[model samples]
Target: MTFAGFLGLALQTIKAPRDVARLLLSARLSSEALWTAFALVVVLNTLVFSATIALMPQDGFGLLGNPVAFMVVQAAALAGAVIAIASIGRAMGGKADLAQVAVLLIWLQSLRVLAQAALMIIGIASQPLAAGLALGVSVLGIWLSMNFIDEAHELGSLFKSAGVLILALMALAVGLSLLLSLLGVVPQGMNGYV
Candidate 1:
């Protein structure tokens, strides 16, 4: 992840919705680059989450009942998320600019990580609600940020689209997590299977 890649993603996310697609299609980044950037963001976000969990001392299942196992599961879950997003991007007619898609993904997903981190610090009881709110707000923020690229901004339309996008992404993430868990590919607690 070069600085340019970071800035490009940030700038693209802040561009218009139509422009976001345009930028992604134009850049045509590779799958490797896209996955790498996604992994980096997930790892960073997971670290923050792990730290929060460590500090809070929760008693429930506690992310597979082991911190290391939890991190591995989270990492796998996030990778699946990246695959899902890339598939979505492609289905949306993105022409496969790996670098650009990577940037866009990083920018869009960073907000989610930040939101989750914030929710975690707030404690588990409020975490779910806070996470949902953050998810909505972050998506809206990204959408609104995109509209700023041009002079004629349609705030209402952008907000509505953002809401839809947020919900879709959230569903996709949850679905991927559950699917992985069910497949028995993801390790349970501290025990290894194989």
Candidate 2:
């Protein structure tokens, strides 16, 4: 897609995520395509986030040292999140299948990467503007992801979906921590790397 088309798609995701999800699901994307999209989104996010952290000139990201390794860990955490959310959501009586959950989560992640890229570019121009926009983007991302999980999983309420999301995030964190420990790799973070 052209850059404008891609930007339009990203804007649509922020403006009307439910409709975006509906259109994405209506396409009946195949399992392979879903996986491909998920991987691409993960890689793109890792690249953007790593670049942002590297360029920060300041600490607090909690993802310090070994950018390559950090990216790998992030990818693993992301995969863990997808699996955990699918399992937990189902256990909580979510009617949606794993594919639906994966697709929506992956799509939202792609949007986040786009937002991060924009934030980084804008940060280069104006630190104050970037800082304010960064906070807004982060909040909007969390809210949108929660809503996406609820809608995609057919969960009845935001609270139910939030519960699932929290559990999934906890699971992802533990899984990543364990993986990092196994590798015996530690770097400096905001409060001493994870």
Which candidate number has the best TM-score?
2
Q: What tens-digit string does per-residue lDDT give for candidate 2 at 35-74?
A: 7987788778878877877787666444434566766786
| Cand. 2 Cα-lDDT | 0.80
Cα-based lDDT for every prediction? 0.55, 0.80
Decoy 1 TM-score against native: 0.50
Model 1: ten consecutive residues of lowest lDDT: 147-156
RMSD of each: 7.6, 3.0
Worst lDDT 10-window in candidate 2? 185-194
Name the runs in model 1 displaced over 4 angstroms.
Answer: 1-32, 85-103, 116-194
Clash counts for the predictions, in order: 11, 0
